[model samples]
Target chain A: MPNNGMGTLLKTPTGISGLDEITNGGFPKGRPVLICGSAGCGKTLFAAQFLVKGITAYDEPGVFMSFEESPSDLTQNFESLGFDFEKLKAEKKLRIDHVRIERSEIEETGEYDLEGIFIRLNYAIDSIGAKRVVLDTIESIFSGMENMTLLRSEIRRLFTWLKEKGVTAIITGERGESSLTRQGLEEYVSDCVILLDFRVIEQIATRRLRIVKYRGSTHGTNEYPFLIDESGISVLPVTSLKLDYKSSTEIISTGLPALDKSFSTGGVYRASSILITGNAGTSKTILAAHFAMSSCKRKESTLFFSFEESPDQLVRNMATIGIDFEQAIQEKMLLIQASRPSLQGLELHLMVLNKLLEELKPRTVIIDPISSLITIGNTNEVRAMLVRLMDTLKKKQVNALFTSLTYDGQSEYNNSTVDAVSSLADTWIDLKNEERNYERVRSLLIVKSRGMAHSNNRHDFIITGKGIQFTTSNKK
Target chain B: MKENTTDVVIIEDKLELTLYISGMSQKSMEAIRNIKWLCDKHLKDAFELEIIDIYKNPKLALEQHIVFSPSLLKKLPLPKRTLVGTLSDTEKVLKSLGITTEK
Candidate 1:
């Protein structure tokens, strides 16, 4: 009865954690999707997360077909992710069926299809009135079944039946050598093809996801890295193609008095994305929070995306330094959105930002240590995502501040990534921290600014209980 | 670098291939200078050469399948060849394209 459509179409939400945001509401709401990935790349985890999350979060009962893991093995593994499969099972909101497809155990002497797995899945779905389903690595039949011809047709039939059932299903495949999936399952699943990749770069393992194809609906075309932690799987929806946004011309203070004076216009323009690149412990988040407090004082909304610390701890720690975010939160002027960069892919983090911006309509957005995001993706991907993010912020006219931590303070001191957005940016601020003689000191520099004149001198500053008050001036 | 006489010239769309180079890095600039000199001296006008700096027009590189710098894409002719480094080697260049130098 609710009208949430552009025309004669409606959208269904996937209760899967961190997915609806990326798909802008989840797989076109009932279209079958192919989630193919390599072995031990968490295909089972990905499928389970979808089912468990659907049942618990959206009241959408789901059926999970496990071709490999026993139902109990899955229950125990996901239990660590805070997913109570047993509880959901008892609630009758969920169902799990392990289709024991041991080629040696079953003798297919005559012609046959995978109607057995279909019947079992249908029974589970019908019993629960399920709206979501998952076929976990069903392509393992490549190794399990000897008759490729019969199995292929059976797999095709299974997908078609899933369509007839009209539930949004996720069919996961093993990243076998022959194809992107062992059995080349992509040729069959038509709605959306999603590839999950687990790669090791510099000895650090990372998981990434990409939507290879999504028919009818427009989707982001970039590899989005995700992570599996205690909270479950977090997929980054990094690229947003929407350019519709508004930019504010008004300039706002960064809370540091002398720093404000150094700006040719006396302050940073609203909706501008400012990058403050520096070495570790350069007070990046602290400085961003200080400016946020200033904005909140002016009765403007601000959103802080902290990659390093939790929002509560950040607020509490800032309190020790005499910056109280509690009052701002109570006043509805400040909201800190904190998450581990490793918790999800870059896009996932960006989607959260998009959500917060839409909900809070903040005047400013702060990302503490954008550099950590670099670890999750390669150079090109990181640069491309930042450009999109910055472009989105500019369109929104939200004053955006991003902190990038670099190891070498003097060298490679500029923002680096997949693409160069410095040309697209309105202003850039660099924060530097080093031991000057025997005393450790912090300084800020205005690297580049478009449209308005800016002071070029680097000024020394320090953190004392009161806040980030500058020790240098540019007004003279 | 040469506004007077186009740094890149394609004889026609016959030159179906084009190598787009971008960036102000010493490597890219030096490679471009050499590609222009060597390509001009050796290949002459028989083959079309197009050189582009990505920094100036980064969007153009992605449009034409260019991932690295100082790349020479022999276009306007069928079957394109891309070289990441210098565009020297006279004998192979002519023989591959079935060209005979008058000199």
Candidate 2:
């Protein structure tokens, strides 16, 4: 849907992260957009960020006509997002008009239109030469005014007038039982319609955004998960439908010389995702720590997500295996984020990871025991999130190493995560703990390494104070 | 006519109203004529009315939070009231404006 040539539709870029990428180029330019959502779904914040970003990033003046909150309330609410509304107002780049429609104060009589509103809007727009406008929850007028037919016609005219005035407008509406909006405002704003939804699945709340309709332009139709934080709204356009990521030919270490020697190419490909699956206490975390240490040694930043242990605990535990992460942490080359898998839903975890990736711009990422994350989500959801995470890392050329814990007797083919990740991973290593001669010994085997040659033999290894050491191979 | 003229001055209570309209549109004209007729038949000379066209004074609309054209606001009376559209319903207008037409 790349718009080129003379027939390209003009677009106004909304500076929200990943939003312009999903909307193709933001909402249809100079047309009214309908944002319908249930209560507390971040609709107003989304609109406010758009207005603020339009002024700050694109130099486009904006008008926010609020039907619910007063101007002071809006200004105070948006202050946490780092928006200086008062300064923008003083600079004549922004105008906030609070339209209070109290149901108890008015008596509707004969034929009348909302001409005063139009005139006021015109005055406000002309006063600041605003190019963008927001009518936050304009549907409140329905509860205040008794005339439905007149209100509907006037609202329809408002949209037409906004387009005629060549200003991009966003009109928010509350979700209705039967329609997209309570008053079915989607019918009036046919150019673009975006729906925000907040759902609590298994007691974990997640917010999502979807484009219900975008006329005369193409958009991502999938329901993308969004995040609302102190900074603002960030929509993760996680639709990596095409397998178009560029592959790298450069080789990288396995962090252990014995493991590197086991591979035919000496090491795995750079930016390739590697999976280390093993039973309990089979040294998965130790191997991931080795990868992180090696990445930091090369001056590359690494992001490690430890679902099982705290950061200090992980650092102390890995220290016993001769992998010192303290220096790396001190050097700011390694960031370990430790949290329980059940602390939030799968989407929130992914969003946190995505946000960290954007902020840190790390080159290596390690997820210790991705199996714990599987316990919180269904099989399909975990797989979808894993795919998105892996695809994002691959697109950024970030080296990723994920460790999964398998049951003692479970077959790799029967495990849902193994089945899902084995196909996507560029390299897979299987670790096992076996008892022989009345003693338990550790072994490692190369499952698959795409685009490279590797040993198929199982090699026995031992963990010492120095690191993982190769002992003997039965060559089976 | 004699009773209405006497009723206009007998109360000595001033009724003040302001009509906010858009330009000189037909709705504005109709609202003006309706209110004038209602006042003549009811309050006579006791009421003071001023009409402000919103188009000429758009800032006034924003300042007063006026949403509809031809809106009548009872400014002087305690517990101020607002009525939108042409004042065609005589009884409802009188009651909402706190005027006793029966006397």
Candidate 3:
């Protein structure tokens, strides 16, 4: 346990990746926090991670009192998440007490309190000197008892006893129809409360976590999407809302000398986001390939996310335009990730991108035709996801290039999907194909470039064996 | 699991019962008094009663899954039954324990 300062409250680190960032530090120490959710939303897993992380990372012993699952079942379930319950128990670092209650086997005659539970918990905690506790779905006790008044009172007392004992505890509950929990367990453990929601929108399932209440602390109030993989739970915090990312003065070439000359600075700023919007045959992907090739030429690792084309397909197609991506792929300076937009939920895609970014430590990233991702989520959700993606890239000081496909007749200024990234982009390039003399002529325009003087005149260009070449009249 | 060997009077019997209490609290005393009276009046010497104070042995509480204090467990009957709380209702307690009273 550690405090941010002298006057700040003590906090326990959860040790789950990305979770502590949103929680500021972690849950309040030496207090009971309620984690309520519907069936199969990962409440049990969250509590288990809290205790297990406490033991392995903080050297604190823990007690797990399960009211639903048996001890064997709990051990087996947590084993998949890399937690060895038996080993921890053998070392006297963890104690699991399974409280089995069957309503049909009991007949309530007169009056009684839950002294048995208190004594058992006390004995277990004292035996191990546990500092962390998890009562997984303690509300299940309500199912085995006929007296609601007595159970509620006993539960209130149990929380008080836990606090008095000076152990940080997590009490999980089932989601209620009206209140936060079915039995209103939130009414008892009120120090801190978190709600997990599992929702399927448009046939794509997303798990979200929200902090309903956290007394005496400042925290992220937005609903953060989380993922449960083999490693454990990792919450994706909606990144810095303030535009405070560091700026870089270094410029990076676009691999096309003609295109570089179009900007006043001769090249785009390093770590800046660039957007390329064009119609079907306007060569948006080709332009993005040029950016990736330039990054690879500079010996900086580049990550390309291809939504519509596979890696081999992209390489082969780019080769036809005199852009040799095969050499860069072989040199290991470029990594291309190809996946369909419908392959998984939006959050999973973001997680995969994050994992790759962390592992590769790439200096530049490209998403070819980001418009395909719009099909997977609603307008607002897709916008939010892109905003988070851009913010993450900006924070890492990684240059990002995104290509968007505009419909033939849809104005680039009017398309909602393109507008989403265009407003946030530091540089915007619009490409168009028009019929002139029964021949399709492709022209490029620099719509807007922030903090730079760029050519606003349309320059007709053509895809040649040497890549994109500006027509003679437009060249300086 | 059968850890109450201290206060057991006899092993072989038609009715084998274990009463789990917490430090002779008021509820535990009432439950002990009521169960003793019912067993003596109904079964006479055919029953064996074992009283366990969980305060002395708290591990047994978890082993037996005793959530509520003053729990009465009938072990010798074909179908075991658990009754929680103080056994103040004599008729209901006897009837639930499979002992019939003449009308």
lDDT of 3 by residue, A96-185 (tens): 999888777788888888998999899999999999999988888888567899889989999999999999999999999999999998
Q: Highest TM-score among the candidates is held by which one?
A: 2
TM-score (C-alpha) between model 3 and the true structure: 0.93
DockQ scores of the candidates: 0.00, 0.78, 0.73
Better candidate number, 1 or 3, judged by DockQ: 3
Model 3 lDDT, full chain set: 0.89
TM-score of each: 0.59, 0.95, 0.93
For residues A1-476, could you state the per-residue lDDT of candidate 1 as single tens digits? 11234533345565555566566566755667888887788777877777877777677888887777888998888888888888998989888876554332232222333433554566678878999898886876667445688778878988888888899898988776878787888999887888889887655566888888877665567676677766667765555545666656787888776777887778887777777766778787788887898888889898888888988898888998889998998998888777878777666676678767888899888888777888887788778778778877777778888777767634533546312545555677767777889988898888887768888788888788877778876643
True contacts kept of each: 0.00, 0.82, 0.90
Q: Write the per-residue lDDT of candidate 2 for residues A245-279, one digit (tens) a residue.
A: 89999989989877887777889999999999999
Candidate ranking (DockQ, best to worst): 2, 3, 1
Clashing pairs in 2: none
Candidate 3 shows a clash count of 0
Which stretch of 10 consecutive residues in model 2 chain A shows the poorest summed lDDT?
A1-10
